[model samples]
Target: MTTILVTGGTGTLGRLVTERLRADGHEVRVLSRHTQPYAVDLREGGPGLDAALDGVETVVHCASSPRGDEQAADHLIAAARRAGVGHLVYISIVGVDRVPFGYYRSKLAVERRIEESGLRWTVLRATQFHDLVVTMLQKLAKPPVVLVPAGVSDQPVEVAEVADRLAELALAAPAGRVPDMGGPHVRTFDSLARAYLRATGRRRRVLGMPLFGKTYRAFRAGGHLAPEQAVGKGTFEEYLARRFGQ
Candidate 1:
């Protein structure tokens, strides 16, 4: 059995990845900042990480922060190198390079670091999760009229599917930047909001607002979509049903 370490073990994706790895009979270690079996701050590069990396064969990096993603990768990569970890699997968002958002830019920077770390590594870029989409729609619904960006599309995947793929990658030899994983369906933002309202039995006016800037332009240009790589089995409707009991 391989000894694996899962960063961001407490987050949505990280927790699922950790469970999958454990179920597959690999020795799994969880690394989180708040509280855990191993409490390690990715931004600090402290002794906690050094201890966690000891004898670890593989590392599935799922911990990422909008502000300190690069810093966390720097520390994790350094510790992994020192510990002679066999493979490093990094979870990334699709269109990080294509999208002009600051968060995506930071993710791309971390991807570059992992590529240059001289370790056997694989980067898996996936579309946004269904949970995120639902959360955003819920927050926007609080307003009198839910306003969505015009010409933007969303392809959200199930978190469990991404977690299963990460476990598969963790067991195999590192393949650099594997094929992207996206949802089964690609729909416009306005349609998604409408579906969400219908699922929750809410009647809110949905408005498509013309958003300006390069970020919206990139998103409208399908920067966040991967129709050719849409391999996830679960649809957004199924996710809504399962999550909300619709």
Candidate 2:
């Protein structure tokens, strides 16, 4: 069995990936900021990272934040190199290169760093998660009227499916930049907000606002969509029913 280390092993996607790897009878190492024995903060380069990478053959990098991801990736690459890890797998958003947002730019930078790190690597770009879409709708519904960006759409994929794909990739040889994974449907933001309101039994008037900006324009133009690669099986309504018991 291969010894694989999963960063952010306690997170939404990482936790599921860890479980899958363990179920397959592989030695799984969970790395997080607070987890003992492997508690190393990737944002800061430290000795704990080296210990975590010890004797690890593959690493599934799932730890990420709104900021400091680039720095974290640099630390991970250096530590993996020192440990002689063979394969490095990364999960990224679909539109990191096309979208001009700060977070997307940071994700793109991490992808580039991994590509040129002189290590075998694979990167998978996926659409937004259903949980993130729900969180966004929750914030929008806080006000009496929910205001969503006009002409913007999203394809929300299930996190479990993403985790499953990562596990499969970890077990196989490194293949750089595999096919993109997208949700089954390309839905508008307002429609998704309405779905959330219905599922939660909330009454809020949803309004679409025409915002003018490069980021918004890119979103409207569907830079983040992967219609040709709609490989995910879950739907937003199904996810809502499972989450809210509707």
Q: Which candidate tops TM-score?
A: 2
List runs of model 2 lying over 4 Å from the truth.
Answer: none
Tell me the TM-score of each prediction against the true structure: 0.98, 0.99
The true-versus-predicted C-alpha distance at residue 207 of model 2, in Å, is 0.7
- For model 1, residues 1-246, the per-residue Cα lDDT tens digits are 999999998899999999998898889999999866689889998988989999999999999886898999999999999999989999999999999999999999999999999999999999999999999999989987999998899999999999999999999999999999999989999999999998999999999999899999999999989999999999999999998899
Tens-digit lDDT string for candidate 2 (34-130):
9988999999979999999999999999999998999999999999999999999999999999989899999999999999999999999999999
What number of clashing residue pairs does each candidate have, in the order they appear?
A: 0, 0
Model 1, position 153, has a per-residue lDDT of 92
